[model samples]
Target: MFNRTENLSLYIKKYPVISVLIGMNLIVYLLGLIPGIGNNLYALGIAYNYSISQGEYWRLITAMFLHGGFLHLLFNMFGLYVFGPELEQLAGKLRFFSIYFISGLLANVATYVVEPLNYASLGASGAIFGIFGAYLALVYHTRKILPQLKQLIIPLVAISVIMTFVQSNINITAHLVGLAVGFILGMFQFTPKRIRRFREK
Candidate 1:
């Protein structure tokens, strides 16, 4: 279910939301490759606590689409590319969008609340981690039939959390908060009654 065998056109047609997200991140990253404008845009794009305090609250949302480097964009987009569609299919587009963006915003907000005002972070890792958290919720929800999911998802989540600490410049708070919020929302969004109803259907 996580595999993608579709061509570009078919993929976009099948997963319009994920495609747009990946495209937006790609566009932002490409624009940030520019010489002078790059630095300026990045300064504005990051989720800076000072900026948020100064009433530039949009950074929480905008930073979800920004990246520090090519690999940063690539990894985040790849996570979206692989995991997003299944959740979109299961949760529907609106719910999927809510889970992703809300988790990201909450993550950034958590950062704003805890970190120094000078703190700034840019990347979709928070949102991607939300997707991971949602997957965990799903596995727990459907463990009877989809027990196999734990093997893939648990290890992936574990490795990600581990990497968060092992890697430098990683926003540990955002990632953890996003994951927690995503799991909560996932549980709220995909209730037991709903899951049972879905299986019945």
Candidate 2:
């Protein structure tokens, strides 16, 4: 299964950023498992909370790369593999990265703002969902250009959202916030003029 997935991932060479991001996530995850090092990895999540109150707010951006457990990293990386390359291909790497990081940051901000006291959240769901939103934007904008893709987008997003709700211990707020931000950003990122310009021959 892993080999097959890797082979499939290779086809997305046009989107180098996705691959690099995935690699970074995996590396961090592995490094986090190194006994004492793992504690530091786990701390990255809560570190932001401490930093925020101390006026060193940049930890918000740093925490997105940290995951709490094997499954957490798995799901986030898997989601990125599933949605990220497509967005990268459509928007190009720089724009895709921007949307991803910004959306993730927004999700973190939402979490921090809404539940200021409960500060144990981590993972790249926000950024991945941003990619999901960007994908939605791309599909919606190009719906007229390529109507067939609509069938794929709607069902995939619906199923993912439903599954997110069903899964326990999942940060529902982060996912929703990420999706919402992604959807909103997708609107502007996939504007008609931009899409037309990107697709120009």
* Winner by lDDT: 1
The ten-residue window of minimal lDDT in model 1 covers 192-201
**Global fold similarity of model 2 (TM-score):** 0.85
Model 1 TM = 0.93
Candidate 1: how many backbone clashes?
A: 0
Give a tens-digit lDDT track for model 1, residues 46-150: 999998999999899889988888888888999899888878877877899889999999999999999999889989988999999998898888788778979
In order, the Cα lDDT scores of the candidates are 0.88, 0.76
Model 1's alpha-carbon lDDT is 0.88
Q: How well does each candidate superpose onto the true structure, as a TM-score?
A: 0.93, 0.85
Off by over 4 Å in 1: 192-201
Q: Report how far off residue 117 is in candidate 2 (Å).
A: 0.9
In angstroms, how far off is 2's CA in candidate 2? 16
